[model samples]
Target: MRLLLFMLGRSIKPAVLITVFVSVVSCVMLTFCEKGGYVFDKEYDSVFTSLEADTAYDKVSEMADNTRAQNDDLAKRAGDYIAAHTKPGSTPPVLPDGLAGQAVRAAQKGGDSSSAGQSELYEFMGSSLKDGKESEQLIGDKLSGYKRNARRGVTDEYSLALSAVLTRDYEQVLDNQQLADKLYDTRAANTYLEYIENDMLFFVLIFLICFSSFSSERQSRRLSAFAITKAGAGRFIFCRIISAGLVCGVCAVIYCLLQFCVMCLSGGAGCLDMPLQYLKGYALSSYAMSFGGLCIAAVVLRVLLAEVLCAAMLLLSFLSKRNITAGLICLAPTAVMIGLSKSDNSTAQFVTCKFSFLFGGEGYVRVFSTPYPVVWLYVLICAFAAGALFITLIAQGQRREY
Candidate 1:
């Protein structure tokens, strides 16, 4: 315990605090200032310039266009093909590359002429929800860890939770033109799509911070000296993992609180339980959420995820001789996750989304709609990753002399 606290104390040096503070401030300011110069000011103008208004209008129009693009007849057909290909009593088919599109186009011969991408997007989401349940079907047999508990949002038997998800997404995306414009008028001051844009830099910054966990210690050769202090390798690795994770988690909390303070100041923290629309099909969900609820949830999950990832970084340090080598190994994946969240910024810049969408808030509607705190499958992946890395590093550490 003393060793753990000591490690954490070392992790929270002034350098860490200063870097985190500066990074958080820079990101929040960059994002918040772009949203028409802060809405909380009493002297704030209640109008958009001609350019701003035109930008908002074009954004919505482009959103619908993008949705239409992603959800062409081919995508709709592909979704159906994927669904049809599934076997009820067997594992879902893991197809070869482009199989979905191949099957979809092969099956369709030009049926519906005037279709919207929202419909196809809904189909894809429904397929995903079904796929998740099917994947969860092995809980009792092969997968003991994934029991069906309603409190955890898991059910042993199949459930059509996808219907509710589809409905919500549809409602939010099909907003009347008037409401769509109102959502982006820069005066409404809601935690809708535009609000999330202000926090993108903050999230990317968190990803960067997490990527560096243990790099400095490894570079400074402290690990070798620390290993000599009367500790078994297993005990040392375990303590270091915990210590690093805890330190990162605490730092993440500090970052989150800073972002939230900025949110409150800029009027981004207004509604705790208001309906939200991502307004873009590239987003994870088209549904609504308690705007504030989503932010809080995003912050908590993203922060904890950073900790787990940091532990993974520590494990990498044990394997790689160079800190830059270890750091790059971690940074590559963070970059990919961030990239997956990207849409054409030119079109999406005014809409205020893509960040949280990439970070796991896309289907958050259904996650919150349920009474129990169900662990998302992606989260389960993180848990598995954290556990695997910690164990692997511990085993490796055990073979070395302290």
Candidate 2:
């Protein structure tokens, strides 16, 4: 324990100033440099005052039902117009002026008449409701048809079972109860999501702290000397890895708290006690949590992933003879992942994207016949990978040679 404390002390010393500087800079940038200034103070205040006068849930439900009905009417009219005017394999005629015409024009831009028409219909629906008008009633009515379509034409047992599980999950989310009394403000959550999505500084700070975890000792020939000590190389390496992880964890906590403080100061924290589903982009989520709970979960998951990254960095530091080598080895794949995340490849995006798990309810994966939360799956995979990396570090450290 003393050795661990000593190692932690050393690891934290150089990181203190860097972490503080980075956290402050990040907060400043998030406040001022973001597209819309921080806290969205004006918008938040306006919405809060409006919500205070009206029952927010009732307003949302009424608007959603109204908009959904309008959307269906527009879609049916557009379909009928296209079918009446165009023959098979012929170009669709210019639609007449109306809401249906607008929908048809929007769909024509995408080339594929059939799929694009449905996409445009939803796009129109989304735009109509984009201004802080969302509710379970709206989501339920919209997704009801989607659920039916998802279950259609599944002949194989595996596909049939998977579809059933997914449809059931969607049904549960649409029917889940949410806090009706709380008022939600999207400003703070939007700021938080935007900040985290572009948070390269966090990873950079972790890399700086852990990139020299063991390589510096090796480079200075202190590693062999430490191997001869009573603690031995294995114990020494373990202490170093643990200390790096702990320091990284502290940094993660500091970062999250700084963000939360910013949100509070901006008046966005009022909605923290509201249901997570009430947040923008999360109306379809199945997670049973409040906005505050989601924030806490995001922080916890981020710290876990940070520790996993710390361990991997330590392994590189342990194996590499120089700190620069360790850094390059760590950075190469990170750069690739970032690039892939920006590409149009769906599979690559799914693997490299952090947003899906960070902000819950984007989608789910099936495990056998059961539907599993993407956040849970991501955490489990990271936990296993961290264990494997730590085990490899220990085994390698136990070798006789430095």
Candidate 3:
């Protein structure tokens, strides 16, 4: 226990203070989430806002109706041909790659003209809703729902633009839950983004952890003289990496718990009911970002370089509008296991909350898969373990110059 405190003490109090400050800030900002709805802000509201409008709805509906009428006219002609060509007991053409062949393949795949027809019907219904009856009712219902949940007013211009998504035409699906599900999906994505963009303190905590860990160690010569003793370079290095990683893990846990408490107080049970899967997702994300910092310290012999690189990597993960922190964490072990993979910016949309992996947030909707967390976390921990071995190897190889 004392040893653990000693290791944590090696990190300056400013780092601890930074973590606390971030936690407080995370709580304050996330409070606005209750009334804010899912939209990021005025600037990017278009990303999620539906694009249907009264004028455009009418036009689309009219166009769909006209197109369906044309298709109906054509279908009648085809029906006439079918009736005239068949004999009492004769089969039709078996030519491959023809319309009939295409029909047959589509049938095997459980899809065909029926599927196309249904899609066309949906499009037609949507268009008719814009141009036809109940247009005003449809617009009102959508706007009311958005306004009730949203923190701010959506502009009239954007609201009019997004009318299409809300105006559905299908008679069959008009009663179905498809629209509800779609709205939920959009909200889920927006909720995730909202948490990511607002968690500035999470980023600050990460930078502080990395910078302080290395700088403090350098000033104290804490890792010194492990060289002259029987403490193998491998064991000594592993200890330092583990020590640093554990500190990061503690800070991350505190950050999350504090945020969770704040979320509960401000938003009530609705906020706290964030599913278990997302909780696990948050844990994995914290480990990935934290471990990445630990590994950086090992490679760059100078603590300052290590600290700067850690800060830089955290920033880089956000550049592509997709999180790649897990992937970067995975590379930690690669440096020694098979040589570091050429670092490149490849964006991925993970099933679990990618933000949870990148920062400590409790606002995830659904858990997609656990394999990503398990696989990457193991790989990252291994990287830190390998970094420990490398340090040990350095200690053993270069004897004292006495």
Candidate 4:
């Protein structure tokens, strides 16, 4: 226990420094970074606020109705103009003032001959007419879906308002049963999601702390004295692993808290009660957790994965003759996983990417005809891997020739 405490004390400084550095970088980037047309900006906040105040669903329903009506009216006008102007053997009428007329003129200018101009003009008219009709129909369908959900007591004005803005391009979510039951302005949730999506920083921190755990002692000749007896070597290995685990666990907790504080300061703390599924990219998740619960789960999972990484690094450090060799060996898999994170293959992503579980998705796996969350499956796998690494380290320690 004394040795474990001493080892932990030795790691405290680097662990604290890494945590502080990561916190500063995260804060600076999140605060100063331009969002570049991100949908959930101040405008979205204001719209959500207005919807919350209205509460009666009248404003949003009216907006949907108005948009549908305007699209239909414009489509009718464009169709009428196209019909009258395209009549055979008739003089071209003066173009009317408006977007439809401007579009016709633009199409006319693109053609090289009268027939070509007429053909281009007709094509533009037909496409515009089709687009307008399609848009109006889409709006109608969305509005009707909202009304149906409202009747089923599944959605409220807030859901309708959010659907109008965020789900405009996702026609399929119009009738999603998991649509948020109340107003949850996703600005806060989105901010939190962005923070947890990538864990490369944590990976690097784990590597720095554990890569020298055994190799440094070995280089200093202290490991030779410790490994002179099997019992002594086993005890020493156990202490080192425990100490590394404790340090990594502390670092994970500190980092999670710091980021959570940042999230709170950025106006997301109150949104922790929001449904997890309400967040972007999680619309299909059936987990019955609030955003806060999801954050807690992510923190726990990160700590577990960090411990697994610590064990692997410790094992490599034990085997390597030099600290630098262990560091390079530890980094190889980390780099591969980082590269694989950008891949489009879902299976590869689920296996190699931390974001696959950190940012929850449709993460269910069937076992014995029963469904279980994939995160738990990952936990089990990590447990087995850690055990195997520990066994390998102990066996190697027992056999090492001083």
Q: Name the best candidate (by lDDT).
A: 2
The digit string of per-residue lDDT tens for model 4 on 256-353 reads 77777767676777668765555655644435566788888878877877777778888888888887888889897567656765566766556553
Instruction: Name the lDDT of candidate 3.
Output: 0.39
The local lDDT score (0 to 100) that residue 110 gets in candidate 2 is: 39
Q: In candidate 2, how many Å is residue 291 off?
A: 1.7
What's the TM-score of every candidate structure?
0.52, 0.72, 0.35, 0.67
| Tens digit per residue, CA lDDT, model 3, 1-402 | 454456557653655677788877776676666335422233223321343433444544565566556556555655665676767889953433454444444334223444334335446335223212342244345446655544365555434333222232122223331222221112222232346333445544655564333233334454355545665434444454555555555666667656555434432333222211122223212121221232232122122222223433322321222223433442342232122112221122221113332233211222242112333443454456445544443353344212
- For candidate 4, the clash count comes to 0
State each model's C-alpha RMSD to the native: 17.8, 10.0, 20.0, 11.7
lDDT of 1 at 74: 55
Tens-place lDDT per residue, model 2, 1-402, is: 999998787768678778888889888877764336332234324433564413554544454465456556668887788789898888888767775455655455333333343343344333323433454665566466555755675466555555555466656654444334444555566667657655677777677777877888898888899899988988887877778778889988888788777776765677676656666667666555666787788788778877777788888888888878887887754565456655656555444445544444545676875556677777888789888998899888888434
Q: 77, model 1: CA deviation in Å? A: 50
Clashing pairs in 4: none
